[model samples]
Target: MKKTGLFFGTFNPIHIGHLIIANHMAEFSDLDHVWFVVTPKSPFKAKQTLLGDHHRYQMVLEATQEYPKLEPCDIEFKLPQPNYTIDTLTHLQERYGDSRQFALIMGEDNLNGFHKWKNYEAILEYYQLYVYPRISGQKIAEALKDHPKIHRVAAPVMEISSTFIRREHKAGKNIRPLLPESVWRYMDEMNFYR
Candidate 1:
Protein backbone atom coordinates (compact mmCIF):
# COMPACT_ATOMS: atom_id res chain seq x y z
CA MET A 1 0.00 0.00 0.00
CA LYS A 2 1.18 3.49 -0.77
CA LYS A 3 1.64 5.70 2.27
CA THR A 4 0.16 9.17 1.86
CA GLY A 5 0.47 11.96 4.40
CA LEU A 6 -2.45 14.34 4.90
CA PHE A 7 -1.13 17.77 5.82
CA PHE A 8 -4.17 19.72 6.98
CA GLY A 9 -4.22 23.53 7.13
CA THR A 10 -6.25 26.63 6.34
CA PHE A 11 -3.35 27.94 4.18
CA ASN A 12 -4.80 31.51 4.01
CA PRO A 13 -2.00 31.86 1.49
CA ILE A 14 0.41 29.10 0.64
CA HIS A 15 3.85 29.90 2.02
CA ILE A 16 7.40 28.57 1.67
CA GLY A 17 7.35 27.13 5.20
CA HIS A 18 4.33 25.01 4.30
CA LEU A 19 6.11 23.75 1.18
CA ILE A 20 9.34 23.01 3.01
CA ILE A 21 7.62 20.96 5.71
CA ALA A 22 5.58 19.01 3.18
CA ASN A 23 8.73 18.29 1.18
CA HIS A 24 10.51 17.17 4.32
CA MET A 25 7.62 14.88 5.25
CA ALA A 26 7.63 13.31 1.80
CA GLU A 27 11.40 12.90 1.54
CA PHE A 28 12.30 12.01 5.11
CA SER A 29 9.27 9.97 6.07
CA ASP A 30 7.61 6.82 4.68
CA LEU A 31 5.01 8.90 2.79
CA ASP A 32 4.94 8.45 -0.99
CA HIS A 33 2.91 11.63 -1.45
CA VAL A 34 1.97 14.54 0.77
CA TRP A 35 -1.47 15.97 0.17
CA PHE A 36 -2.09 19.55 1.29
CA VAL A 37 -5.65 19.30 2.58
CA VAL A 38 -6.82 22.88 2.23
CA THR A 39 -9.57 23.30 4.74
CA PRO A 40 -12.53 25.52 3.91
CA LYS A 41 -13.43 26.27 7.51
CA SER A 42 -11.84 25.11 10.69
CA PRO A 43 -13.86 24.80 13.85
CA PHE A 44 -11.18 26.37 15.97
CA LYS A 45 -10.37 29.28 13.66
CA ALA A 46 -12.21 32.47 12.84
CA LYS A 47 -14.07 32.12 9.52
CA GLN A 48 -14.23 35.90 8.97
CA THR A 49 -10.45 36.04 8.66
CA LEU A 50 -10.24 33.32 6.01
CA LEU A 51 -9.91 33.99 2.32
CA GLY A 52 -12.31 32.21 -0.05
CA ASP A 53 -11.81 28.45 -0.13
CA HIS A 54 -11.39 28.39 -3.90
CA HIS A 55 -8.71 31.07 -3.70
CA ARG A 56 -6.81 29.24 -0.98
CA TYR A 57 -7.06 25.98 -2.94
CA GLN A 58 -5.87 27.65 -6.12
CA MET A 59 -2.88 29.21 -4.37
CA VAL A 60 -1.94 25.80 -2.95
CA LEU A 61 -2.15 24.27 -6.43
CA GLU A 62 -0.02 27.03 -7.92
CA ALA A 63 2.57 26.79 -5.17
CA THR A 64 2.85 23.02 -5.37
CA GLN A 65 3.03 22.73 -9.16
CA GLU A 66 6.76 21.97 -9.20
CA TYR A 67 6.62 19.17 -6.65
CA PRO A 68 5.37 15.91 -8.10
CA LYS A 69 4.76 14.46 -4.65
CA LEU A 70 2.87 17.48 -3.32
CA GLU A 71 -0.85 17.66 -4.13
CA PRO A 72 -3.49 20.16 -3.09
CA CYS A 73 -6.73 18.42 -2.18
CA ASP A 74 -10.27 19.85 -1.99
CA ILE A 75 -11.86 16.85 -0.32
CA GLU A 76 -13.24 18.91 2.54
CA PHE A 77 -15.03 21.28 0.16
CA LYS A 78 -17.48 18.53 -0.74
CA LEU A 79 -18.00 17.56 2.87
CA PRO A 80 -20.16 19.32 5.47
CA GLN A 81 -19.15 22.70 6.84
CA PRO A 82 -17.08 23.09 10.06
CA ASN A 83 -14.87 20.24 8.89
CA TYR A 84 -13.65 17.68 11.38
CA THR A 85 -10.48 15.71 10.90
CA ILE A 86 -11.99 12.39 12.03
CA ASP A 87 -14.84 12.62 9.55
CA THR A 88 -12.49 13.51 6.69
CA LEU A 89 -10.16 10.65 7.51
CA THR A 90 -13.05 8.22 7.75
CA HIS A 91 -14.33 9.30 4.37
CA LEU A 92 -10.88 8.96 2.85
CA GLN A 93 -10.36 5.49 4.34
CA GLU A 94 -13.66 4.30 2.94
CA ARG A 95 -13.02 5.84 -0.43
CA TYR A 96 -9.44 4.59 -0.82
CA GLY A 97 -9.89 1.27 0.97
CA ASP A 98 -6.67 -0.72 0.85
CA SER A 99 -5.28 0.97 -2.21
CA ARG A 100 -3.57 3.57 -0.03
CA GLN A 101 -2.56 4.05 3.56
CA PHE A 102 -3.15 7.51 5.02
CA ALA A 103 -1.15 9.12 7.77
CA LEU A 104 -1.60 12.46 9.53
CA ILE A 105 1.11 15.11 9.24
CA MET A 106 0.84 17.79 11.91
CA GLY A 107 2.85 20.20 14.01
CA GLU A 108 3.66 19.31 17.61
CA ASP A 109 1.50 22.28 18.72
CA ASN A 110 -1.52 20.57 17.18
CA LEU A 111 -0.70 17.41 19.09
CA ASN A 112 -1.03 19.40 22.29
CA GLY A 113 -4.64 20.09 21.43
CA PHE A 114 -5.36 16.67 19.98
CA HIS A 115 -7.64 15.63 22.75
CA LYS A 116 -10.07 18.44 21.99
CA TRP A 117 -10.83 17.16 18.51
CA LYS A 118 -13.80 15.01 17.70
CA ASN A 119 -13.02 11.31 17.94
CA TYR A 120 -9.47 12.19 18.85
CA GLU A 121 -8.76 8.78 20.33
CA ALA A 122 -10.11 7.07 17.25
CA ILE A 123 -7.75 9.14 15.13
CA LEU A 124 -4.85 7.99 17.25
CA GLU A 125 -5.94 4.38 16.94
CA TYR A 126 -6.48 4.37 13.19
CA TYR A 127 -3.85 6.64 11.63
CA GLN A 128 -0.18 7.17 12.30
CA LEU A 129 0.81 10.74 13.16
CA TYR A 130 4.02 12.27 11.78
CA VAL A 131 4.73 15.21 14.08
CA TYR A 132 7.16 18.00 13.26
CA PRO A 133 8.56 19.98 16.16
CA ARG A 134 7.22 23.43 16.99
CA ILE A 135 7.93 26.02 19.64
CA SER A 136 6.31 25.16 23.00
CA GLY A 137 5.58 21.57 21.92
CA GLN A 138 8.07 19.81 24.13
CA LYS A 139 5.61 19.26 26.96
CA ILE A 140 3.02 17.65 24.71
CA ALA A 141 5.69 15.54 23.06
CA GLU A 142 6.86 14.23 26.40
CA ALA A 143 3.34 13.23 27.37
CA LEU A 144 2.79 11.29 24.17
CA LYS A 145 6.32 9.98 23.93
CA ASP A 146 5.23 6.42 24.57
CA HIS A 147 2.44 6.39 22.01
CA PRO A 148 3.20 3.67 19.46
CA LYS A 149 1.59 5.38 16.46
CA ILE A 150 3.27 8.76 16.82
CA HIS A 151 6.47 9.32 14.85
CA ARG A 152 8.52 12.42 15.64
CA VAL A 153 10.04 13.93 12.52
CA ALA A 154 13.21 16.02 12.46
CA ALA A 155 11.90 18.54 9.93
CA PRO A 156 13.24 22.06 10.48
CA VAL A 157 11.04 24.32 12.55
CA MET A 158 10.47 27.42 10.48
CA GLU A 159 9.44 30.44 12.55
CA ILE A 160 7.48 31.85 9.63
CA SER A 161 3.71 31.93 10.07
CA SER A 162 0.75 32.69 7.81
CA THR A 163 -0.50 35.12 10.44
CA PHE A 164 2.82 36.94 10.34
CA ILE A 165 2.83 37.01 6.55
CA ARG A 166 -0.71 38.35 6.40
CA ARG A 167 0.10 40.95 9.02
CA GLU A 168 3.13 42.08 7.06
CA HIS A 169 1.18 42.30 3.82
CA LYS A 170 -1.57 44.28 5.50
CA ALA A 171 1.08 46.68 6.81
CA GLY A 172 2.35 47.14 3.22
CA LYS A 173 5.55 45.29 4.03
CA ASN A 174 7.13 42.85 1.59
CA ILE A 175 6.15 39.24 2.26
CA ARG A 176 7.80 37.75 -0.84
CA PRO A 177 10.29 35.78 1.20
CA LEU A 178 7.51 33.93 3.03
CA LEU A 179 5.72 32.68 -0.08
CA PRO A 180 6.38 31.12 -3.47
CA GLU A 181 7.12 33.69 -6.14
CA SER A 182 4.05 32.76 -8.16
CA VAL A 183 1.81 32.90 -5.11
CA TRP A 184 3.35 36.20 -4.10
CA ARG A 185 2.50 37.65 -7.50
CA TYR A 186 -0.99 36.24 -7.34
CA MET A 187 -1.59 37.81 -3.93
CA ASP A 188 -0.26 41.14 -5.17
CA GLU A 189 -2.22 41.15 -8.45
CA MET A 190 -5.38 40.19 -6.64
CA ASN A 191 -4.82 42.67 -3.76
CA PHE A 192 -5.19 40.04 -1.09
CA TYR A 193 -4.83 40.72 2.62
CA ARG A 194 -5.31 44.45 2.11
Candidate 2:
Protein backbone atom coordinates (compact mmCIF):
# COMPACT_ATOMS: atom_id res chain seq x y z
CA MET A 1 0.00 0.00 0.00
CA LYS A 2 1.28 3.45 -0.87
CA LYS A 3 1.09 6.09 1.82
CA THR A 4 0.45 9.55 0.44
CA GLY A 5 0.69 12.90 2.21
CA LEU A 6 -1.34 15.81 0.86
CA PHE A 7 0.07 19.22 1.73
CA PHE A 8 -2.52 21.85 0.81
CA GLY A 9 -1.70 25.51 0.22
CA THR A 10 -2.25 28.44 -2.13
CA PHE A 11 1.51 28.44 -2.78
CA ASN A 12 1.23 31.93 -4.31
CA PRO A 13 4.84 31.29 -5.19
CA ILE A 14 6.38 28.07 -3.92
CA HIS A 15 9.33 28.94 -1.69
CA ILE A 16 11.98 27.26 0.44
CA GLY A 17 9.80 27.10 3.54
CA HIS A 18 7.14 25.00 1.78
CA LEU A 19 9.72 22.61 0.33
CA ILE A 20 11.53 22.23 3.66
CA ILE A 21 8.34 21.27 5.46
CA ALA A 22 7.29 18.78 2.78
CA ASN A 23 10.76 17.18 2.77
CA HIS A 24 10.78 17.11 6.54
CA MET A 25 7.41 15.41 6.70
CA ALA A 26 8.42 12.78 4.13
CA GLU A 27 11.70 12.17 5.96
CA PHE A 28 10.20 11.87 9.43
CA SER A 29 6.73 10.47 8.80
CA ASP A 30 5.51 7.16 7.35
CA LEU A 31 4.44 9.00 4.17
CA ASP A 32 5.97 7.45 1.04
CA HIS A 33 5.33 10.56 -1.07
CA VAL A 34 4.41 14.18 -0.45
CA TRP A 35 2.18 15.92 -2.96
CA PHE A 36 1.97 19.68 -3.11
CA VAL A 37 -1.75 20.39 -3.55
CA VAL A 38 -1.58 23.86 -5.02
CA THR A 39 -4.94 25.39 -4.30
CA PRO A 40 -6.30 28.03 -6.68
CA LYS A 41 -7.57 30.29 -3.94
CA SER A 42 -8.17 29.51 -0.33
CA PRO A 43 -11.69 30.47 0.73
CA PHE A 44 -10.32 31.55 4.12
CA LYS A 45 -8.01 34.16 2.61
CA ALA A 46 -8.40 37.44 0.73
CA LYS A 47 -8.49 36.77 -3.00
CA GLN A 48 -7.34 40.08 -4.40
CA THR A 49 -3.66 39.30 -3.95
CA LEU A 50 -3.54 35.80 -5.37
CA LEU A 51 -1.54 35.12 -8.51
CA GLY A 52 -2.87 33.11 -11.46
CA ASP A 53 -3.48 29.46 -10.64
CA HIS A 54 -1.31 28.09 -13.46
CA HIS A 55 1.58 30.35 -12.42
CA ARG A 56 1.49 29.12 -8.85
CA TYR A 57 1.23 25.53 -10.10
CA GLN A 58 4.23 25.97 -12.37
CA MET A 59 6.25 27.50 -9.57
CA VAL A 60 5.61 24.43 -7.45
CA LEU A 61 6.58 22.15 -10.33
CA GLU A 62 9.77 24.11 -10.97
CA ALA A 63 10.76 24.17 -7.32
CA THR A 64 10.08 20.51 -6.62
CA GLN A 65 11.18 18.88 -9.91
CA GLU A 66 14.66 18.11 -8.55
CA TYR A 67 13.28 16.07 -5.66
CA PRO A 68 11.89 12.67 -6.62
CA LYS A 69 9.91 12.44 -3.41
CA LEU A 70 8.11 15.73 -3.98
CA GLU A 71 5.23 15.98 -6.49
CA PRO A 72 3.17 18.95 -7.60
CA CYS A 73 -0.53 18.22 -7.89
CA ASP A 74 -3.20 20.15 -9.78
CA ILE A 75 -6.17 18.18 -8.52
CA GLU A 76 -7.98 21.34 -7.54
CA PHE A 77 -7.66 22.80 -11.00
CA LYS A 78 -10.11 20.29 -12.40
CA LEU A 79 -12.40 20.78 -9.46
CA PRO A 80 -14.45 23.90 -8.69
CA GLN A 81 -12.85 27.12 -7.49
CA PRO A 82 -12.74 27.98 -3.78
CA ASN A 83 -11.99 24.27 -3.40
CA TYR A 84 -12.60 22.62 -0.04
CA THR A 85 -10.05 20.33 1.54
CA ILE A 86 -12.64 17.69 2.36
CA ASP A 87 -13.85 17.58 -1.24
CA THR A 88 -10.33 17.08 -2.55
CA LEU A 89 -9.71 14.36 0.03
CA THR A 90 -12.89 12.59 -1.05
CA HIS A 91 -11.87 12.74 -4.69
CA LEU A 92 -8.40 11.41 -3.92
CA GLN A 93 -9.80 8.51 -1.93
CA GLU A 94 -12.17 7.48 -4.71
CA ARG A 95 -9.54 7.90 -7.41
CA TYR A 96 -6.57 6.39 -5.61
CA GLY A 97 -8.48 3.54 -3.91
CA ASP A 98 -8.16 1.74 -0.55
CA SER A 99 -4.67 0.31 -1.05
CA ARG A 100 -3.38 3.83 -0.57
CA GLN A 101 -3.78 5.82 2.62
CA PHE A 102 -3.98 9.60 2.43
CA ALA A 103 -3.15 11.98 5.22
CA LEU A 104 -3.62 15.71 5.48
CA ILE A 105 -0.51 17.79 6.23
CA MET A 106 -1.21 21.21 7.69
CA GLY A 107 0.19 23.87 9.97
CA GLU A 108 -1.00 24.24 13.56
CA ASP A 109 -2.30 27.69 12.68
CA ASN A 110 -5.00 26.16 10.47
CA LEU A 111 -6.12 23.76 13.18
CA ASN A 112 -7.73 26.56 15.18
CA GLY A 113 -10.07 27.19 12.28
CA PHE A 114 -10.53 23.55 11.38
CA HIS A 115 -14.01 23.59 12.78
CA LYS A 116 -15.02 26.09 10.13
CA TRP A 117 -14.02 23.77 7.32
CA LYS A 118 -16.76 22.10 5.36
CA ASN A 119 -17.59 18.73 6.96
CA TYR A 120 -14.66 19.25 9.28
CA GLU A 121 -15.59 16.46 11.64
CA ALA A 122 -15.96 14.02 8.75
CA ILE A 123 -12.44 14.87 7.61
CA LEU A 124 -11.11 13.96 11.03
CA GLU A 125 -12.99 10.70 10.92
CA TYR A 126 -11.83 9.81 7.42
CA TYR A 127 -8.22 10.97 7.25
CA GLN A 128 -5.26 11.46 9.56
CA LEU A 129 -4.04 14.95 10.34
CA TYR A 130 -0.30 15.66 10.32
CA VAL A 131 0.39 18.88 12.15
CA TYR A 132 3.51 21.03 11.96
CA PRO A 133 4.46 23.97 14.17
CA ARG A 134 3.62 27.39 12.79
CA ILE A 135 4.37 30.98 13.82
CA SER A 136 3.05 31.07 17.41
CA GLY A 137 0.07 30.53 19.72
CA GLN A 138 -0.60 27.14 18.13
CA LYS A 139 0.04 23.66 19.49
CA ILE A 140 -0.87 20.37 17.80
CA ALA A 141 -2.10 18.49 20.88
CA GLU A 142 -4.22 21.33 22.18
CA ALA A 143 -5.73 22.35 18.85
CA LEU A 144 -6.59 18.86 17.65
CA LYS A 145 -7.39 17.34 21.02
CA ASP A 146 -10.83 16.15 19.91
CA HIS A 147 -9.54 14.40 16.79
CA PRO A 148 -8.25 10.87 17.28
CA LYS A 149 -6.41 10.66 13.93
CA ILE A 150 -3.84 13.31 14.63
CA HIS A 151 -0.05 13.13 14.33
CA ARG A 152 2.17 15.90 15.64
CA VAL A 153 5.31 16.05 13.57
CA ALA A 154 8.67 17.14 14.99
CA ALA A 155 9.87 18.84 11.81
CA PRO A 156 11.83 22.09 12.08
CA VAL A 157 9.71 25.25 12.06
CA MET A 158 10.50 27.22 8.92
CA GLU A 159 9.95 30.93 9.45
CA ILE A 160 10.17 31.78 5.76
CA SER A 161 6.99 32.24 3.70
CA SER A 162 5.93 33.17 0.15
CA THR A 163 4.21 36.26 1.55
CA PHE A 164 7.54 37.53 2.87
CA ILE A 165 9.30 36.78 -0.40
CA ARG A 166 6.60 38.47 -2.49
CA ARG A 167 6.76 41.54 -0.28
CA GLU A 168 10.52 41.69 -0.66
CA HIS A 169 10.34 41.23 -4.42
CA LYS A 170 7.64 43.87 -4.76
CA ALA A 171 9.79 46.24 -2.71
CA GLY A 172 12.66 45.85 -5.18
CA LYS A 173 14.68 43.75 -2.75
CA ASN A 174 16.50 40.43 -3.01
CA ILE A 175 14.68 37.13 -2.49
CA ARG A 176 17.38 34.90 -3.97
CA PRO A 177 18.18 33.28 -0.64
CA LEU A 178 14.54 32.61 0.17
CA LEU A 179 13.85 30.33 -2.81
CA PRO A 180 15.62 27.72 -4.91
CA GLU A 181 18.04 29.12 -7.51
CA SER A 182 16.11 27.46 -10.34
CA VAL A 183 12.83 28.93 -9.16
CA TRP A 184 14.44 32.34 -8.75
CA ARG A 185 15.79 32.18 -12.27
CA TYR A 186 12.42 31.11 -13.64
CA MET A 187 10.68 33.93 -11.84
CA ASP A 188 13.35 36.38 -13.00
CA GLU A 189 13.19 35.25 -16.63
CA MET A 190 9.43 35.62 -16.69
CA ASN A 191 9.41 38.75 -14.49
CA PHE A 192 6.74 37.13 -12.36
CA TYR A 193 4.79 39.15 -9.81
CA ARG A 194 6.71 42.31 -10.71
Candidate 3:
Protein backbone atom coordinates (compact mmCIF):
# COMPACT_ATOMS: atom_id res chain seq x y z
CA MET A 1 0.00 0.00 0.00
CA LYS A 2 1.10 3.57 -0.66
CA LYS A 3 1.76 5.48 2.54
CA THR A 4 0.65 9.09 2.04
CA GLY A 5 1.02 12.06 4.35
CA LEU A 6 -1.78 14.62 4.19
CA PHE A 7 -0.39 18.09 4.82
CA PHE A 8 -3.48 20.24 5.01
CA GLY A 9 -3.20 24.03 4.96
CA THR A 10 -4.69 27.20 3.57
CA PHE A 11 -1.30 27.90 1.94
CA ASN A 12 -2.39 31.50 1.19
CA PRO A 13 0.92 31.47 -0.60
CA ILE A 14 3.07 28.38 -0.71
CA HIS A 15 6.52 29.07 0.68
CA ILE A 16 9.93 27.41 0.92
CA GLY A 17 9.24 26.41 4.51
CA HIS A 18 6.12 24.51 3.45
CA LEU A 19 8.09 22.79 0.70
CA ILE A 20 10.95 21.96 3.04
CA ILE A 21 8.70 20.33 5.62
CA ALA A 22 6.69 18.40 3.06
CA ASN A 23 9.85 17.17 1.37
CA HIS A 24 11.38 16.27 4.68
CA MET A 25 8.32 14.24 5.66
CA ALA A 26 8.37 12.43 2.35
CA GLU A 27 12.02 11.58 2.71
CA PHE A 28 12.45 10.93 6.40
CA SER A 29 9.09 9.50 7.42
CA ASP A 30 7.51 6.25 6.32
CA LEU A 31 5.39 8.22 3.87
CA ASP A 32 5.73 7.46 0.17
CA HIS A 33 4.04 10.69 -0.93
CA VAL A 34 3.10 13.97 0.73
CA TRP A 35 -0.06 15.60 -0.55
CA PHE A 36 -0.47 19.32 0.05
CA VAL A 37 -4.21 19.39 0.76
CA VAL A 38 -5.28 22.97 0.12
CA THR A 39 -8.39 23.73 2.09
CA PRO A 40 -10.84 26.33 0.72
CA LYS A 41 -11.45 27.63 4.19
CA SER A 42 -10.35 26.30 7.52
CA PRO A 43 -12.82 26.41 10.41
CA PHE A 44 -10.07 27.61 12.72
CA LYS A 45 -8.91 30.45 10.44
CA ALA A 46 -10.50 33.64 9.23
CA LYS A 47 -11.60 33.30 5.62
CA GLN A 48 -11.66 37.01 4.71
CA THR A 49 -7.86 37.22 4.89
CA LEU A 50 -7.23 34.14 2.78
CA LEU A 51 -6.40 34.25 -0.90
CA GLY A 52 -8.99 32.67 -3.18
CA ASP A 53 -8.93 28.89 -2.94
CA HIS A 54 -8.04 28.37 -6.59
CA HIS A 55 -5.21 30.89 -6.37
CA ARG A 56 -3.78 29.22 -3.28
CA TYR A 57 -4.16 25.83 -4.92
CA GLN A 58 -2.35 26.96 -8.06
CA MET A 59 0.45 28.48 -6.02
CA VAL A 60 0.93 25.14 -4.26
CA LEU A 61 0.95 23.35 -7.62
CA GLU A 62 3.62 25.69 -8.96
CA ALA A 63 5.73 25.52 -5.83
CA THR A 64 5.69 21.72 -5.69
CA GLN A 65 6.43 21.09 -9.37
CA GLU A 66 10.01 20.03 -8.79
CA TYR A 67 9.19 17.43 -6.18
CA PRO A 68 7.87 14.18 -7.60
CA LYS A 69 6.48 12.93 -4.31
CA LEU A 70 4.81 16.19 -3.41
CA GLU A 71 1.32 16.62 -4.87
CA PRO A 72 -1.05 19.58 -4.58
CA CYS A 73 -4.58 18.33 -3.92
CA ASP A 74 -7.90 20.12 -4.51
CA ILE A 75 -10.13 17.53 -2.90
CA GLU A 76 -11.33 20.00 -0.32
CA PHE A 77 -12.44 22.44 -3.03
CA LYS A 78 -15.05 19.94 -4.09
CA LEU A 79 -16.09 19.38 -0.50
CA PRO A 80 -17.80 21.71 2.00
CA GLN A 81 -16.47 25.08 3.07
CA PRO A 82 -15.00 25.86 6.50
CA ASN A 83 -13.54 22.42 6.02
CA TYR A 84 -12.74 20.15 8.93
CA THR A 85 -9.68 17.88 8.71
CA ILE A 86 -11.58 14.81 9.82
CA ASP A 87 -14.20 15.10 7.07
CA THR A 88 -11.50 15.46 4.44
CA LEU A 89 -9.70 12.42 5.79
CA THR A 90 -12.88 10.38 5.85
CA HIS A 91 -13.58 11.20 2.23
CA LEU A 92 -10.02 10.35 1.22
CA GLN A 93 -10.25 7.02 3.02
CA GLU A 94 -13.42 6.14 1.20
CA ARG A 95 -11.82 7.07 -2.09
CA TYR A 96 -8.32 5.69 -1.69
CA GLY A 97 -8.23 3.53 1.40
CA ASP A 98 -7.89 0.34 -0.59
CA SER A 99 -4.54 1.36 -2.01
CA ARG A 100 -3.30 4.11 0.27
CA GLN A 101 -2.61 4.52 3.95
CA PHE A 102 -3.11 8.16 4.96
CA ALA A 103 -1.38 9.97 7.80
CA LEU A 104 -1.95 13.51 9.04
CA ILE A 105 0.96 15.97 8.89
CA MET A 106 0.61 18.94 11.20
CA GLY A 107 2.57 21.43 13.28
CA GLU A 108 3.01 20.92 17.00
CA ASP A 109 1.05 24.13 17.53
CA ASN A 110 -1.99 22.44 16.04
CA LEU A 111 -1.43 19.56 18.37
CA ASN A 112 -1.68 22.02 21.25
CA GLY A 113 -5.29 22.59 20.32
CA PHE A 114 -5.95 19.19 18.84
CA HIS A 115 -8.50 18.42 21.51
CA LYS A 116 -10.71 21.23 20.34
CA TRP A 117 -10.95 19.99 16.78
CA LYS A 118 -14.20 18.53 15.50
CA ASN A 119 -14.29 14.81 16.24
CA TYR A 120 -10.72 15.05 17.53
CA GLU A 121 -10.72 11.68 19.22
CA ALA A 122 -12.04 9.96 16.10
CA ILE A 123 -9.18 11.49 14.12
CA LEU A 124 -6.68 10.03 16.54
CA GLU A 125 -8.31 6.66 16.37
CA TYR A 126 -8.26 6.55 12.59
CA TYR A 127 -5.06 8.19 11.41
CA GLN A 128 -1.45 8.53 12.46
CA LEU A 129 -0.32 12.12 12.98
CA TYR A 130 3.17 13.37 12.07
CA VAL A 131 3.85 16.49 14.10
CA TYR A 132 6.69 18.87 13.28
CA PRO A 133 8.25 21.26 15.74
CA ARG A 134 7.13 24.88 16.01
CA ILE A 135 8.26 27.79 18.13
CA SER A 136 6.36 27.90 21.47
CA GLY A 137 5.35 24.27 21.10
CA GLN A 138 7.20 22.85 24.06
CA LYS A 139 4.29 23.02 26.48
CA ILE A 140 1.94 21.19 24.13
CA ALA A 141 4.68 18.76 23.20
CA GLU A 142 4.92 17.83 26.84
CA ALA A 143 1.15 17.51 27.06
CA LEU A 144 1.01 15.07 24.19
CA LYS A 145 4.18 13.21 25.13
CA ASP A 146 2.36 9.99 25.77
CA HIS A 147 0.05 9.96 22.73
CA PRO A 148 0.97 6.86 20.78
CA LYS A 149 -0.66 7.91 17.50
CA ILE A 150 1.30 11.15 17.16
CA HIS A 151 4.86 10.91 15.87
CA ARG A 152 7.22 13.82 16.42
CA VAL A 153 9.26 14.35 13.27
CA ALA A 154 12.80 15.75 13.42
CA ALA A 155 12.12 18.21 10.59
CA PRO A 156 13.89 21.56 10.68
CA VAL A 157 11.84 24.27 12.36
CA MET A 158 11.73 27.41 10.27
CA GLU A 159 9.85 30.42 11.62
CA ILE A 160 8.54 31.34 8.18
CA SER A 161 4.83 32.08 8.09
CA SER A 162 2.32 32.98 5.37
CA THR A 163 0.82 35.65 7.63
CA PHE A 164 4.24 37.33 7.89
CA ILE A 165 4.71 37.14 4.13
CA ARG A 166 1.29 38.66 3.51
CA ARG A 167 1.97 41.43 6.00
CA GLU A 168 5.35 42.23 4.46
CA HIS A 169 3.97 42.18 0.92
CA LYS A 170 1.10 44.45 1.93
CA ALA A 171 3.72 46.77 3.41
CA GLY A 172 5.42 46.92 -0.02
CA LYS A 173 8.42 44.84 1.00
CA ASN A 174 10.00 42.14 -1.16
CA ILE A 175 9.05 38.67 0.08
CA ARG A 176 11.02 36.74 -2.51
CA PRO A 177 13.33 35.13 0.02
CA LEU A 178 10.37 33.69 1.90
CA LEU A 179 8.56 32.11 -1.02
CA PRO A 180 9.16 29.84 -4.00
CA GLU A 181 10.29 31.83 -7.04
CA SER A 182 7.33 30.77 -9.17
CA VAL A 183 4.79 31.49 -6.44
CA TRP A 184 6.42 34.84 -5.73
CA ARG A 185 6.28 35.79 -9.39
CA TYR A 186 2.68 34.71 -9.66
CA MET A 187 1.67 36.67 -6.56
CA ASP A 188 3.58 39.67 -7.86
CA GLU A 189 1.94 39.47 -11.28
CA MET A 190 -1.49 39.20 -9.73
CA ASN A 191 -0.82 41.93 -7.18
CA PHE A 192 -2.01 39.66 -4.41
CA TYR A 193 -1.79 40.63 -0.72
CA ARG A 194 -1.22 44.26 -1.72
| Stretches of model 2 off by over 4 angstroms after superposition | 138-143
Question: Which structure among the candidates has the greatest TM-score?
Answer: 1
Clashing pairs in 1: none
Residue-level lDDT tens digits of model 2 in 37-58 = 9998889888888888888888
- lDDT tens readout by residue for model 1, 21-94: 99999999889999999999999999999999999999999999999999999999999989999999999999
TM-score order of candidates, top first = 1, 3, 2
- Strongest candidate by lDDT: 1
Q: In model 3, where do residues sit more than 4 Å from their true spots?
A: 141-143
What is the clash tally of candidate 3?
0
Of 2 and 3, the candidate ranking higher by lDDT: 3
Models sorted by lDDT, best on top: 1, 3, 2
Who is ahead in lDDT, 1 or 3?
1
Candidate 3 residue pairs that clash: none
TM-score of each: 0.97, 0.94, 0.96
Per-residue lDDT over 30-121 for candidate 3, one digit per residue giving the tens place of the 0 to 100 score: 99999999988888888899888889999999999999999999999999777888889999999999999999999988887888999998
